[model samples]
Target: MAKPQIYDVLHREHEEVSELFHQLEEAKGAEALELFARLKQKLVPHSRAEEAVVYPRLLEESNTADTTREGIEEHKQVDKLLAELDAMTPDNEVWQAKIKVLADMVGHHVDEEEGELFPRAKQVVSDQEAEQLVDEYARERDSFVEDIRLEQRDAAE
Candidate 1:
């Protein structure tokens, strides 16, 4: 079987996060907490993995650098929002409102990525490289996720 491409990996994560955000919107109290945790579990590591494996490669081409940089900057903004969301109590009146904003930000970012970045990346990154990066991205994301699970388990214990 053919291995997945980097676009496939990132796009799949984007869809999953979008669905999780929808679930989060309907969730309350502990459900919201659980859903938010799951969202973060996917998002943080995905951003880091993209940075580690994809962005630098895109940075190699002068033309793609700006878009690559913009994508990273967007991730930074989302991280800030995620941190703010993390700080608020689930019961806080503003929490859901702020989460809606976060969801919009993420949706816009994903649209830019899939619409522009991924297509442009095909020109910059060779087929072989894209395939290799998929595995690398997965490893980086999974390791970070495992660490998060460990931390959460320790905090609960």
Candidate 2:
């Protein structure tokens, strides 16, 4: 069986994050906070894995520097919004606005990746190489999750 494409995994995560964002919109107070937390949990490592492993490989192999560069800029925008969301309470109007902005930014980012980067990447990397990249991404994602958990625990104290 062919290994799953990295784009497939990332695209699925994007959909999951979108779902959590919708859940946040419908929720209030603690429930909204919980949904935001879940969104963070899903996004952080996924971003890290893409930036650390996937983007670099795509940049090198596909020679699509412009696309990768745009992706990095999008990551910065998303991270800034995420940081703002993390710092504010769900009850804050500003936080709500920021979350909406985040959803928009992420939606654009996901479209770019799925529409542009993934197709270009497939043209460059072989199935075996894609599998290897996915494997490396999984390891990095696991480590990222552990780090976030530790940070969350510390923040809870």
Candidate 3:
């Protein structure tokens, strides 16, 4: 069987994150907090893996960098919102507004990536290279998850 492409994995994760954002919007109290936590859990590693593995590769190979650059900028914006949300309690009105902004930003980011960046990337990267990237991205994602877990544990102490 052929290995799955990096785009396939990333795209699926994007869909999952989108669902979490929807859940966040509908949730209340502890449930909302839980959904927010899950969003962070999925997003941090997914973004890191793209930054660590995918974006640099695209920068090297793709002459058209506009889409990828936009994606990176979006990542920074999302990171800022995530940090703000982390510092806030769900009970705060401002926190809810901030989360709504995050959801909108993320939705736009994912649309851009799926619509533009991935298509451009596919033009440059061969299927085999895409598979290799998938492997590397998965490994990076796992490492990121471990690091975040450790940080959370330390923060809780």
The order of the candidates by TM-score, greatest first, is 1, 3, 2
- The candidate, 2 or 3, that scores higher on lDDT is 3
Q: Which pairs clash in the backbone of model 3?
A: none
In candidate 2, list every pair of residues with a backbone clash: none
lDDT of 1 by residue, 1-157 (tens): 8778999888889999999999998889999998999999999999998898889989989868898899999999999999899898789999999889999999999998999888888987888888999888889899988988999999999
For residues 47-110, what per-residue lDDT tens digits would candidate 2 score against the true structure? 8888899888877864566798899998888888887877888889787778778888888888
RMSD of candidate 1 to the truth, in angstroms, is 1.1
- CA lDDT for candidate 3: 0.88
TM-score of 1: 0.95
Which portions of model 2 miss their true places by more than 4 Å?
none
Shift in Å, residue 136, candidate 2: 0.5
CA lDDT of each candidate?
Answer: 0.91, 0.85, 0.88
- Candidate 2 has a TM-score of 0.94
**Per-residue lDDT of 99-125 in model 3, one digit per residue for the tens?**
889989998988888888888888999
Q: Whole-model lDDT, candidate 1?
A: 0.91
RMSD of each: 1.1, 1.3, 1.2
Which model is ahead, 1 or 3, in terms of lDDT?
A: 1
Off by over 4 Å in 1: none
